[model samples]
Target chain A: MPTDHIMKTYDDELKRLNNAIIRMGGLAESQVAASIQATVKRDSELAHEVVEQDAQVDALEAEVEALAMRLLALRQPMARDLREIVSSLKIASDLERICDYAANVAKRSIALNQAPVAKPVYAIPRMGKLAQALIKDVLDAYVQGDADKAMHVWLSDEELDELYTSLFRELLTYMMEDPRSITAGTHLLFMAKNIERIGDHATNIAETIYYLIHGTPLKEARPKRDRSSTSVVLPGPVAVATTDSEETK
Target chain B: MPTDHIMKTYDDELKRLNNAIIRMGGLAESQVAASIQATVKRDSELAHEVVEQDAQVDALEAEVEALAMRLLALRQPMARDLREIVSSLKIASDLERICDYAANVAKRSIALNQAPVAKPVYAIPRMGKLAQALIKDVLDAYVQGDADKAMHVWLSDEELDELYTSLFRELLTYMMEDPRSITAGTHLLFMAKNIERIGDHATNIAETIYYLIHGTPLKEARPKRDRSSTSVVLPGPVAVATTDSEETK
Candidate 1:
């Protein structure tokens, strides 16, 4: 009877830990979606609400961390069980960062409201939608222990990167054409970057999910198309002037 | 005798875990410094070397994760011991990210080398120096389990933020003044942001160290002065024209 009771207690604690992560994930998804809506509509009130809602995500992260630590000490879970608890800690950290990026988008929306519209705000909203979808899909994957769903989310991040790169070039063009647009354009650029980073966090979660189920790190290289600046590999040294025109594009 | 043997084995594993993190921290610090050197000197070979060195950091992270999980499952350490193992995992993750950012700076250096010089690259190197110093100090704090040193590193991130904000404005001015400089200016902006993020990861380490030693979070809000767009708080709707000039400055 005592053995059965201890087993039941362990199962209950595990369920609670999973539920905490689910709640945190839901909060993060809503915060990100609302922040994007606030930016696109220039609704400062909505933006303020997104900023205020971030506190809940932060608190939930703390709760998840505490619970995971307690499980580690008390249960001494082995193999897959250990992976599940540790991965929860990692996912919670990623979710918190996603919430932070959402808050950044909200804050930038306010500053963007103060400036004249630089360009039609189409791409950033698209990127945000993609990022939010990835977050949701990865969380569902976590619940089901579905590595296939997580892999799908991981592969789709390249699309977000492609969108970001094109938007980046367009923003630069706007700023260059009209010096007056620099202020608004810069804020828009940051918003796009924030969404891009959220996409990265989603990828991190997907990778974590894969590790949890498989008991091994994802061995494949992450599909990446972020060719903005950092990923560009150069050939042998050539005259700087010759490459200037090619780079300016 | 059996209990003594088990305790000794546990202590030895903990020492190994600490050593792994210290090694990873040292590698991350060197990578950051080398990438910055590669950027300032426009040395493609050195930049390539930094990129290659990242594999070692990634391997070290995996090793640390494995060791931590082993310790948790085998020892079921209570209280402070549990915190120490979990904190090592978190610190190792942070260190890996810091190394990734350093690799990013190196990648950008190759791209920036192909373009004509945008502005004298003074501020970014200085920012890199500050970030490198923070990484070193936080690692020392981790080794000593000194909460005070960790807190000091946590507070000093504000200086990096101030420098980043000033650098941000200067980059915008350069891009606006000359359309031709946009490509190079954009790359430099990313490098600066990368350094700023390294500072953030350093602060993350500080927080983790504090939690490990003190058994509680650093309850004080992190000191922040990053007033570039995302940190700005908006007042009630004012004349758009009135805010435009202020924003440009």
Candidate 2:
């Protein structure tokens, strides 16, 4: 094939690969959302669905790996293209692991259903939403190659941590007050912790974006919570860019 | 340079890089161990030592990265060398993150020093030991290029999960029986969870080994725990091959 033809084909392959990863991301994110809903709504069926679908997540990861390997072996991708391809592989693994933690959360939710919750789980649901949103934004950032947006996702981790900490304190109070609260309160804590981990995985993805573009790891990516230069109004979430702020909404 | 000389130089650089990573692993392992000691024994000074040493850990990471980058640019390595170098980058990042978690745990310990712990923290010390052992084994495996040994570290994640679950239950039980246990017990639980995460970082290294060597992803690493065939002696730790089964005296 001609060089132009090959370049065009490689570009197309890269697009397909990114789309496949986003589709996987959608699945992973929904697992987290459904898992939270399973606990909040006491829906064993939804929890079960999350559990059963883990295998599908696993399979998708394998497919992504296979696709990445095929591209690397055939294309001999260089520099930026290499970074983008490698990032996909790493991000897919990270997403798959996120799904596992989400599944674990759902399983714990089901297990805790037998006992009364130690206290109302008001914070966990919000924290879950926040984490899920951060992950969504990170995925959006990646598809659009938006580093700044990815950094925004990175900044969101602290809020999740704070919410998790509050939930931790509340559940501990309930458990301390009544022996019967032990079983369920413990499960809730694990669920919250699992969600916190999901946020960390999203942060990992953002850090990878920094690497893909600059070949330099951001030593500290925690968005300046106090806000100095973080508030850039980039193009709405879909125009792809070679840089980190492209909006792939 | 002749291929032989180039090969010799590349081999030397890779070995040096690997040694640097192992040294970093040793420091991280000590940080976890020392942090736990400080927390459990209320040794504030030891906690400070770990904190003070973290900058050194960060420095080591920077040095290793500079070395790896120089090797990549100078040697223009082939695929296998490329894999080794990339794995070094990732493993260092994971180790650095693990150390950060250890320091965070110690920080929480400092906070908890304001009051006595409600119960003996049996699970945390054990979890730390397990995590340390996993890191030791994975580093050993990677250095030796022993796929089987690496596989065992990968499966060891289940052990961490099981330990975490038991710790959660035990902590919850303490809190249920005593309200004063709430704050201390919750911090302890998060600390234990951090230790468990160290095991996870080791598992990530193991998967990286599989990818670098076999060029395939082990997607079902978690759901199926039967990967003993990849170990050094594992019909039991790796000697049997089960070094982990060695008497914990």
Candidate 3:
């Protein structure tokens, strides 16, 4: 075959690999949305369906990995092509994690369904929607090689974090107000956390896309506002000591 | 230079890369240990030290990535060598995450230190020890290319999960017994979760090492016994209906 023909064939393979990534991303987004719906409607069947659907995402991840490896070995792609292939591997892994988080949400939804509805479940589903949208936008950016769109998705994760903080507080209140709510409230808390993590994974993909396009990672610190229990406040100069006796009381 | 000289140089570079990984892994393990000590002892200075130490891990990760990319682009290693370089990239990422989890734990320890001890903190320290050990063992496996040792680290994560479940139950009990405990209990819960996640990352490294040596993923499913709120029991053929009204009350 002529060199031009070989190059054309390589380009086609790259295009097919890109399509596979987008398909996996779409499946991941659907899993997140379906899991949230199952949680809100207390529909165990929908949750089960979401769990079953995760196998497709897993399979796609394997396919993307194999194809990317083949491209690397056969084509010996350099610079931009190298970045694209590597990013595909990284993005597929991130998508798989997102799918796992969604499946986790589905599992939690089933557990929550068995228990009483502890508190009004509004914020978690909102966070889920935000996470799902972020996944869509990032995958679009991946397809278009649009760094701007990827940055937007990356910056928007703070909203999901804020929503997670509020939900964390509300769940704690519910569990505190009525001890009977503890079991179900805990499940909701984990589900909310799963959604928040899904948002993080979406941002991860955005970073990968940005790197693929720009040949450099986003330099700024990730925009983060998760004020949950793990949110770290850097200590002031000297550790301010509170009276231990007063705290124990 | 002869082909033998070029091969020698490549081997040396690979050795340097492996050393960097082990160094990063050690820093991560120390960070985890310090964070746990700070939490248990309520030593804010120790926590601050752990937080500050994370920068080294981050720098090491960047170095590892550069070296791995250089090897990939210049050497174009194939088969096992390719897997080794690729797995180094992945293991470095996981170590970075483990370091972040440790830093998060330290930050939470500072936050929790301001409040009275919510409950006896026995289980969390034990879980931290287990997580730290897993990090150490997995990294050792990486250095020795010991798949069996890596598998041991991977299988041992279930113990961490079980410990986390018991700690979750204990913390919930403390919060329910005293509303004032909620503040501290929440922080402890997050710390426990951070430790649990560190263990998960260690398992991720184990998986990578297993893949690196065997050229195939471990066939068995990851052993998981996290009976936390997220653990799901699939519904039977017939949905077992509970008295929802009683649960609400």
Lowest-lDDT window of 10 residues in candidate 3 chain A? A240-249
lDDT, model 2: 0.71
lDDT of 2 by residue, B1-249 (tens): 698997887789888998899899899889988988988788877877776788788888887877766665566565677677767877887888789778767766665675575574766778888888888898888878888888999887778766765565556556555556666676676677677778778888888888778765565535332121111211111122211211000
When 2 and 3 are scored with lDDT, the better candidate is: 3
Q: What is the per-residue lDDT of model 2 for residues A131-200, given as tens digits with 9 covering 90 to 100?
A: 8998899989888888889888887777776676556556655655554555566567667777877888
lDDT of 2 at B14: 87
Tens digit of lDDT per residue, candidate 1, span A167-187? Answer: 777766666566666667777
lDDT of 3 by residue, A1-249 (tens): 699999999999999899999899889878888989998999999988887787778789879978987887788788898888888888998999899888878877877886666564777778888998899999888888899999999999888887887677667666566665665766677778788888888888888888888887766768667767443212223222221210000
Measured on C-alpha atoms, candidate 1 has an lDDT of 0.82
Runs in model 3 with CA error above 4 Å?
Answer: A230-249, B2-5, B230-249
TM-score of each: 0.91, 0.80, 0.89
Arranged by TM-score with the best first, the candidates are: 1, 3, 2
Ranking by DockQ: 1, 3, 2
Docking class of 2: incorrect
TM-score of 3: 0.89
Error of 3 at B206 (Å): 1.3
On the 0 to 100 scale, the lDDT of residue B65 in model 1 is: 93
